[model samples]
Target: MALDKSIGVGMIFIASFVFLYYSIWVFILPFINESSFIQQFFLPRDYAIKLPLLLLLLSGLFVGIFVGKVLIKNQQKQKSKKKSQ
Candidate 1:
C-alpha cells in the first residue's frame, strides 16, 4: 500500500544517512587534521571500532540465547509428545 511504501522509503533514507555518517566518521575523519573543526563533531576515533565491535558482540550473544531457548522449547515439546504417545 501507499503507507507501506512510504515507510520503506523513509527507512531506507534513514539507513543511508546513518551509513554515510558513520563511514565519514570512521574512514574519512581519521585522515583529516585532528585540530580541524570537523573532528569536534565526531567522537574520538577509537570508538569507531569499539562501538561496532561491542554491538556485534551483544547481538551475537542475544542470537545465541534466542536459538538456545527455541531449541530447549522444541526439545521439551518433543519429549512431552513422546510421553503422551
Candidate 2:
C-alpha cells in the first residue's frame, strides 16, 4: 500500500538523520571549540559513548530473555503434544 511505503520511507529518513546526528556529535563535535554554539545542542562527550554502550547491553539482555522464553514455551507445547499422543 502507499501508506505503508510512505511510513517506511519516513522511518528510513528519521533513522538516517539520527545516525548522522550522532555520528557528528561523537566523531566531529569534540574537535570543535568547547564554547561553540553547537556544543549546547548535544550532551557531554561522555554520554555519546556511554549511552550507546548501555543501549547495546540492555538490548542484548532483552533479546536473550525473549529467545529463552520462546524456547521454553515451545518446549512446553511439544511436551504437552507428546503426552496427548
Candidate 3:
C-alpha cells in the first residue's frame, strides 16, 4: 500500500540519518583524547574510522534495498489485484 511505502521511506530516511550522525561521531570522536601518532596509524584509530563508515554505508544500502523491495512487492500485489478485478 501507499502507506506502507511511505512508512518504509520514512524509516529508511531516519535510519540513514542516524547512521550518518553515528559515523561522524565514531569517525571523529577519538581524535579528542589520543596521541597524534596513535590516532593516525594505530589499529584502534584505523578501525574507528573504517568500521563506522562501512557500517554507515552498509546500513544505508540495506535500507534502500528494503525500501525498494517493499515498493516492488506492493506494486506487484496491486497489479495482480487489478488484473483479477
- By TM-score, the best candidate is 2
- Estimate, for each residue in 1-85, the C-alpha lDDT of model 3 and write its tens digit: 6999999999999999877756655666565666555344335546656887898999999999999999999999999999999
Top model number, lDDT: 2
- Model 2 bad stretches (over 4 Å): none
Error of 2 at 34 (Å): 1.2
Candidate 3 minimal-lDDT segment of 10 residues: 36-45
Q: Per-residue CA lDDT of candidate 1, range 1-85, in tens?
A: 6999999999999999989989999889979999999988899878888999999999999999999999999999999999999
Give the higher-lDDT candidate: 1 or 2: 2
TM-score of 1: 0.81
C-alpha RMSD for every candidate? 2.0, 1.4, 9.1
Q: lDDT of all the models against the reference?
A: 0.94, 0.95, 0.77
Pairs of residues at least 3 apart in sequence or in different chains that clash in candidate 1: none
Regions of model 1 farther than 4 Å from truth = 1-7
The order by descending lDDT is 2, 1, 3
Q: TM-score for every candidate vs. truth? A: 0.81, 0.87, 0.50
Ranking by TM-score: 2, 1, 3
